[model samples]
Target: MPTISRQGTDFIYQQVTRFISGQISSGVLQPGDRLPSLRRLSDRLSISVPTVRQAYVELERQGRVESRPQSGFYVRARARNALMKPAPCRDCKPAPVRCRSLIDRVYEGIHRPGVLPFGIANPSMAKPAAKGLNRAMKRVMARAEERSIGYAPSDGEPSLRRQIAYRYLELGGAVEPEEVIITNGGQEALSLALMAVAREGDVIAVETPTYHGALELIESLGMLALEIETCPEEGLMLSSLRSAIDRHDIKVCLFASALNNPLGSATPDEHRQELVALLEAHDIPLIEDDVYGDLRFDGTRPSPARFYSEKGLVLTVGSFSKTVAPGYRVGWLLPGRYEERVRTLKRALSCSCGLLQQMTLTEYLASGEYDRHIRALRPVLEQNAERMTGLIGRHFPGETKVSRPKGGSVLWLELPRKVDGGHLFGQALDENISICPGMLYSPSRRYRNFIRLSFGHPWSDRIEAGLETLGQLVSGH
Candidate 1:
């Protein structure tokens, strides 16, 4: 969605190219992974078949992926050289959060007008998604009965719950409609899941440089966060997780199942299976934040850890915010064995989410437009991430190390240790640009020399200028 001139002839082709490149960098398209057939991909992304072909040809030219006469395009094995995985943090003990003020300051600058938005993780509202949701909302509003404006069932609108469960079927998840509890957003779902399994003063295992919101919630709830080292591309390091498990009484482990923030790592299928087994062995519950699971650039969605939890120990949380509509504020939780407890918590939290929003999303899903919109959206996101990473590499210091995420819209950068991330944040803000300081991502102030940049917005000359300014600032201007 980066600001491309609508008049540009190669807009669609460029989108496809960036999407494929992002998939390659982010590990969504593993080495030698075959890409979708042109016809299938064109149908899937709702672009012209020729556009997909042209994009693939372009990728071949760049050596990002390759093609054969009979076989389809496969990600070139050499493309792996572009991705650099950061060394995992070593401290595995629980650390009390102390970055509240820094987080609040970063968020304050995030929505300020005229500032380059390289801070928030969610994508900019694309036209197709906006139009689809709007159409659905108008239809629902016109047909609404008096009940449509009243409080929804605490478990959420039945139709919406059913649609959520059905979508999970694609991921091989066995969520029943009755098990889905709707909440305000993924945040509420996570809060409910944590409350269902753990109490105050308990320790929760989390990925290093994990979602700041999770750390904030844990701090607010009087819980301690045991930080586990996570790989830049593959997500949580299971060995570190196990070590933390042995060292601390981790009541619950909260992690991203796909497209983790900042690092943009997606755990492979094998890792997901092993992660589930490890936690289940210790009788610990796992809360999986899968809000970004649907935005994979590889065009093939990865299954969440909850799909592997046969013993009902995995609580899966997701939302429409990241993909469809953030303003809708609609999200759900598959509470596993703690359904009743989560339902009670939802009722206690806000009674119910906005009824009309839930109804609108249900309508949107039923119309089968969600698939078309997601297909289009993922390519745009991948394109944006690809461009942003390239910009950072070209403009930032040569010693900088950046993560090549398989999906998601954020890039994590490890700058020279001499660089001060806090100062970089202040300088960027002074120039009307916003970025997330890496220290805020950890409870123990790790990654102080790093920063997380969001490529969720459409690219533009102004964005390029901002990056140039950031480069200058980072180089001690």
Candidate 2:
């Protein structure tokens, strides 16, 4: 997990605070939405009851949520003053003593006059698809009388799930309609997957330079991580994975088979097939993150982990947030073996998706509108990634080595050891660049010299100017 600081408060309390804040920001905990009981939260996140209570006390103090005595805690209606961001402590938390993610560093580097950032993965939204999507949402709203008011299904609408399953085929993964479970987003899908398969203190094998978000999830669940080094060209290094497996007992290995976070490398078909075989031979399960499966800019889509093993050993996670209307927060997972367990977890959490969202997406996907939108999106993403890479080459220091991913919107950069990006974060914030640092991705807290750059957002003149500014900073360094 990205090394986060404790605010002199206990760890559980701190985690509870951040959890509520994100839920509030995302509207998941709608205005007046009742929060789960302290006992419930304690059991859920596996913290002490008192720890959950302390966190709630802080939330109430800030008016972010309310306590109604006998009834329970309810989400307080706080006016979002964009200025009101949650502070971790009296001071903004800096990088930990050891860096965790290079994605974090790219964000820091962008704020300076130097430091060209080839970090953070974000898709550009200024394209025919985005414009078309805006129109599509408006069109859907035009029939609000016929839409909007219906309550949504708890396990997601049948139609939407089917459509989502169909989209999987376009990407080369065979997903049956019954196998799909719609979620609030990829995060929810992942959380459900974790809850379904793992218990407290279970060991989950993760890629060496993994996504920090996944690492955070593992830590939150009181789990230990076994890191496996992956190659730049071949993606995950299975030889090391096999060695780790033989040496230690593990619960599951979570990986991105297509374009992974930060690194943006695609695991080849042979390696992917090998991964499935290795896991099956070892009787280990895998959580395959294919969120960026549809964003490939060139060549055939890489095969999902599902191809080799159809059962519970491989659960393929997907999300429309990156591809379609991000704000819709629609995502799904094809849990081959753990299907029932994952569904049960989803029901416990939020009880399925909004009816209107499901309907809109179902219509979009079934009508073949989704494929056309993706077809339009891919080229722009390719162009943007190429453009950013060119900029980094011309601007960043010569010691940096950047990943040339075939698809996806993120570029992972390997910087010189002379740079400890965690140290440079405060300075970057001063310049207002707002990029995600690189150290947030690793579990062992190394990788202080890497960064993740987002090439997925709209490539406008302003963004281009920001890139130039980022380039100049790296050149100056």
What CA root-mean-square deviation does each model show from the true structure?
A: 8.2, 23.8
TM-score of 2: 0.73
Candidate 2 local accuracy as lDDT?
Answer: 0.69
Estimate, for each residue in 1-477, the C-alpha lDDT of model 1 and write its tens digit.
Answer: 233334767678897888778877776675446788999987777767898899999999987776755657866544332445545566556767777898889989998997788888776353237877889988998899776789888889999999998988866766789988998999999999999999888998888778899999998888889888788877778887777777778899999957678788888879988999998888899999999888877777878788788788999899998888888889999898898888787888788889999999999999999988887777677656656666676678777777877777787888888998888998899999999999888888878898998877766788779988998898883
Candidates' C-alpha lDDT: 0.82, 0.69
Candidate 2 ranges with C-alpha deviation above 4 Å: 1-120, 124-128, 138-147, 169-174, 475-477
Q: What is the Cα-based TM-score of model 1?
A: 0.84
Best by lDDT: 1
Q: In angstroms, how far off is 426's CA in candidate 1? A: 1.1
Which pairs, if any, clash in model 1?
Answer: 1-458, 2-458, 2-459, 3-458, 3-459, 26-405, 26-406
